[model samples]
Each structure stands twice: as C-alpha cells, then as structure tokens.
Target: MEVSKKNKLNKIVKEIETCQACNLCKNRIKSVVSRGNENAKIILIGEAPGKLENEIGKPFVGKSGQQLNDLLSKVGFNPEQDIYFCNVVKCRPVRNNKDRKPNKQEIEACVKYLNAQIEIVKPEIIILCGNTAKKIFKINKPLKMVHGSCIDYKGIKLIPVYHPRASIIDEVKFNDLKKVKKLRG
Candidate 1:
C-alpha cells in the first residue's frame, strides 16, 4: 500500500531519484521528481524536462520557466511557497538525437510517479501546462478547445493552459497569457 504524504515524500523523492523505468533514464543525468512544500495547495504539471532542465536536474528552470514565473507572479502564486511543480515524465525524452517528446512508454512509466506525487500533495487545484499534463487527470476532453477553461474532477479542479514553449515559437504569447489569467480566476 502507498504511505501517507508525510511518510512518503522522502521515500518518493528517493525512489524517483533512482528511477530507470524507461529508455529515457539511460540518457538523463538525473530524474527530477516533484518539488515544493509537502502541503502545497496548487500543483503545476508540465510535459517533461527540456535541455536545461535535463542538464540541471530541475523542472521548469529554463526560459519557459521564466515566462511561467512571470505569469504566476501576475496571479499572486509563489512557486516556492504556494505551489508544487512537476512533469508528466521525470526524465528527458529525446528524439532524433536532438529534439524530444515524451513517448507513450515513458509517459506510462512515469504515471505512477505522478500519481504518487498527487497523493502526497493532495492539491486543491491542478494546473495542466499542456495536453500531456491534462491527460493525468484522465478527463475526456479536447485540450485545445478547452484550454483556458476549468473542470472539476473527483473533487479537485483542473485548469489547462498552453505550454510556455508555445510562446517561444509564435505569437501565441497573448493567447497563453489569456489562458493563464483564465486559469487564475
């Protein structure tokens, strides 16, 4: 059986630190589990580790993370104090020996970890940073069509927002900002 939050936070962190469930683990320097207060009220889930995150063994610590931080500040959310942040997969999923996307197997392998994190934090609200993040909620809805809307599932509320990477490529910065605002409200 799974242990309670207080009993398992350290255990879970240790387990994830040594996880090698999929091929991605072979290439990662470190597997990053969720990080934040043990009793965070909001959980932010993103896709997976990027180049910088993989190098640093931290999630959301790149340029995209800066944008996320700005938006969170706008909504009065302090990542270090009020929220827990994690990813759909703990390891970096690479492809073409350069780019990356979390494969089905890797995602499946990490789902248990994600579930464990949720069980520990028991956040009141979950912010899905993209489609992959939304999937963990097991909700049957088109993320694109409902990106900025909120849905309640099994007592917890989820708000799907655009991935910060989307803003890196196009003029979607405005759209992403709007989604963040909607999510906050």
Candidate 2:
C-alpha cells in the first residue's frame, strides 16, 4: 500500500513539475510538491507555497512550518508520521518578489493537482489551514468563527484552523489542536 501511495504521489509530482496552467508557473523556482509522510492519515492543505517553500522545493516549511511543528508536537502529534502537507496551489504566486494569495485563475488551474493529492493520500482528516481552504470548501464564516471546528465534508472530518504564522501559540489554536488530536483517536 505504501509503495502504491508513493508511486501515485510521484506521478502527480511529475505532472505538477511541468504544469503551466497559469501565469504563476512562469516565475516559479520549483513546483512545491508536498512534505511529510505520503501514507499519513492527515492531510494539511495550506494556501500556496511561500518564498522559502519555493526556494527549498518543499511545501509548508520555514517559520510558519516551525510554528506548525511546535503546535503539533505540543498536541502529541508527530509531524512526520501523522500528517502530509500540501497547498491549494503547487506554485508560488509572486509579484514584486512578494508572495501573495493564489488568485482565482491560479487556484482553478491547480485544483486538479490538489484534488489528486487528496485522492492519493486518502487521509482520515483534512485540516484546512487559513482562508484558502475556507474559500475552496465554501465555508462562509471567517477563520475566527470557524477555526478548529470539525465539520462533515463529503463524509470526511474537515477542520478549519488558522495557518500558523505567529511565533507564540495562543489559547484557541492550542486548544483547537488538542481537539483535532482527539479526532485521530
């Protein structure tokens, strides 16, 4: 099963590497595929690759990734074995060397790749990090209201949580992660 999962993921990665479905592909250093266990039970979907992620050729790394790591560890989740990380869009959306949220066209172009990752990973839980997943999933409520709530999406457990960018873990996020941990029980 693990071999099958890796094979499928690698096929998707190859497709993402040559993707030119949108303008975002033109300036990318590399198509940030994914990071973490391919056989993980949780799929963490972020907005898009950032500058560091693009440079390093990995999804969800650097400071925000560090914050996520610490949070997950605090909640007794092993970042490596428990979760798989990817983004809404595989390429970094940049303008003036500044990273930006994926626009509608960019997101649309990459939707197939993202869907393929989810299908291949087949995680038990999908953690929607930040507004991107909220928008993609059509959750109208703001992150403040929706962050940490487990909702039934396509019969899968979907939890919307703030994308960790801050250095400190606040009460709500910490508590939310604790709740999310229970979902894996």
Model number with the top lDDT: 2
* Whole-structure CA lDDT of model 1: 0.76
- Model 2 lDDT per residue over 1-185, tens place: 35698898899989888888999988788889899998888998989989999999898788888888898999999988899988999898988989888899889888898888888888889999888877888898988888889898887789999888733356777888888899896
True lDDT of residue 185, candidate 1: 52
Candidate 1 lDDT over 1-185, as tens digits, reads: 86668678778768877887888878787776766666777888999988788888778888988887777776666667777889999888887667477887889988998888887788888888887888767765876677767688778878787787773443354454455445555
The true-versus-predicted C-alpha distance at residue 71 of model 1, in Å, is: 0.8
Candidate 1, run of 10 with poorest lDDT: 167-176
- lDDT of model 1 at residue 17? 78
Query: Lowest summed-lDDT stretch of 10 residues in model 2?
Result: 165-174
Question: What shift in Å separates residue 14 of candidate 1 from its native position after superposition?
Answer: 1.5
The true-versus-predicted C-alpha distance at residue 103 of model 2, in Å, is 0.4
Q: Indicate the residue-level lDDT of 162 in model 2.
A: 83
